[model samples]
Target: MLGNGLLKGLTETARNFFGSYVDKDRLTTIQYPEERAPRIEASRNFPFLVYDGTDPQAGLRCVSCLICEKECPPKCIFIEKSTDKKPDAVGKPQFYPTRFNIDVSVCMSCQICVEVCPFDAIKMDNDFEASATGRFSDLLWTKERLAKSNEYYHHIHPTEAADVDAVLAAARAKAAAPRPPAPSAPGGAPEK
Candidate 1:
């Protein structure tokens, strides 16, 4: 009648209110901490190292290439290559990150670290609950803290991890293949 326009809004509000009780999908509000939303495969927050096997340091795929650290726009990543080489997940004896650290307080979460890493060691984590009480110690996460199992990486990003794993397996197979011996000279003398 007089308030036909207002009546429509009121009717919608009533419908929404009743639907919230009956319809499982009608609830729009998500209770934090207790009720977590569905995981988004593409979502990323902070950078974490991906390690395979039981040992985090030895199994780390980083290879101390420093690509991620160099590409980080904020310069939040710091890494020190180990002098001693260790067998990595891909069966290559490579230098590991002895002093890898990330200033999470200054990290912008641009995901450049994950993108520039050639070894697939770095990936962005979906966990956004990195609260720090102390600035220096708490905010600056070391290699041990940042390291996560390969399974964790797969859990967070199944498609990306699968692609990376395929490349790693190929590399390992190539490295394992026997190299052909060098050819000898015309007079049966080995080439210098």
Candidate 2:
């Protein structure tokens, strides 16, 4: 009876060996490079920021709030706020960022910058093709490198990007809408 149990196990193994070949046609093992593979949209592997180009400034939505720089675990973000003179006054601190940089080599891509940005100035991009053969300083990304069109964002993550756009549009509409005219006055004559 003990030998009979071993014989049953061997039979099961043999059955499995044959089943593998029998179901080979149903299996999907793509040959790398030779056979192209389809990518699913929900996969998130890279980090990038989305820019709205509608603005005349080429649409850098970051307000230079320094939240991203402060929250960055690695302190990869470098920002330089610009000093602009007021239109009516003589001297004033405009606080517009004249320079912004992110050391991509050190960035962990944790998406924390994207999450903490109150202005939605940053988002995770799907571009994982960044490579360079130079010093660490060479990998430092400037604002120019990070900027990406809003359309590109929608193309990468259509559902999520569209939802965010819809919300933004609604908020803008509410802000732009004029307030209702004052209830006419107490009775008929307009109140001064």
Candidate 3:
């Protein structure tokens, strides 16, 4: 019986060993660079910010709230708010950030900045091609460099982008629609 068990184990091991070569056509592992790998969709990653290029004030979404800056654990965000001119207009604080910078060298890609932004101004990009040599400033990205077209975001994440656009469209429709007249009180009672 002991010998039979050992023989069975050997047979199973040999089968597994030879099976790989036997089914080699089904294997899909490709050598990097020599063979191109399949591309991953952007929604596989967490959300990030994007700008709408056709809008002249695309960057206006980032109200200089500093919420993202405060929430950033790496302290990579640097914002210089502009001076406030008007005091009474329900205006967001006038501090237009003269310099908004994120040091890619220190970024952990946590998506915290994207999460806390009330304006939905910032989002993560699928682009991972940022590589350079020498100097910390070289790694620091400015607002201009970070701004990407909303169309680009839609291209990367069609489903999610479509959902967001649908919500915006519904909100615009609701805002533009006329309000219904208030219902009269039940049994002809005077309306409050």
Highest TM-score among the candidates is held by which one?
1
lDDT of 3 at 91: 34
Shift of residue 57 alpha carbon in model 1, Å: 2.1
Ranking by TM-score: 1, 2, 3
Candidate 1: tens digits of C-alpha lDDT, residues 1-192? 999999999999999989889997988879979988877999988899989998887788788888888999999999998899877765767888899999998899999888788777899899877887887899999998999999999998999989999998898787789977877666877756
Q: Which parts of model 2 are misplaced by more than 4 Å?
A: 1-40, 54-57, 85-96, 179-192
Q: Which candidate is the best by lDDT?
A: 1
lDDT of 1 at 73: 96
Query: What lDDT score belongs to each candidate, Candidate 1 first?
Result: 0.88, 0.70, 0.67
TM-score of each: 0.83, 0.66, 0.62
Per-residue alpha-carbon lDDT of candidate 2 for residues 59-177, written as tens digits (9 for 90 to 100): 56666788988999988888876565222111222244567888887888788888898767688776655777877766987777777778877887889888888887787688679
Error of 3 at 36 (Å): 4.5
Rate residue 46 of model 3 by lDDT.
28
Q: Which prediction has more favorable lDDT, 2 or 3?
A: 2
Pairs in clash, predicted candidate 3: 48-123, 48-124, 49-122, 49-123, 49-124, 82-95, 82-96
lDDT of residue 167 for candidate 2: 84
**Candidate 1 collision pairs:** none
Off by over 4 Å in 1: 1-3, 21-25, 180-192
Candidate 1: 10-residue stretch with minimal lDDT:
183-192
lDDT of 3 by residue, 29-85 (tens): 787658765445653332334655454233444667788889999888887666652
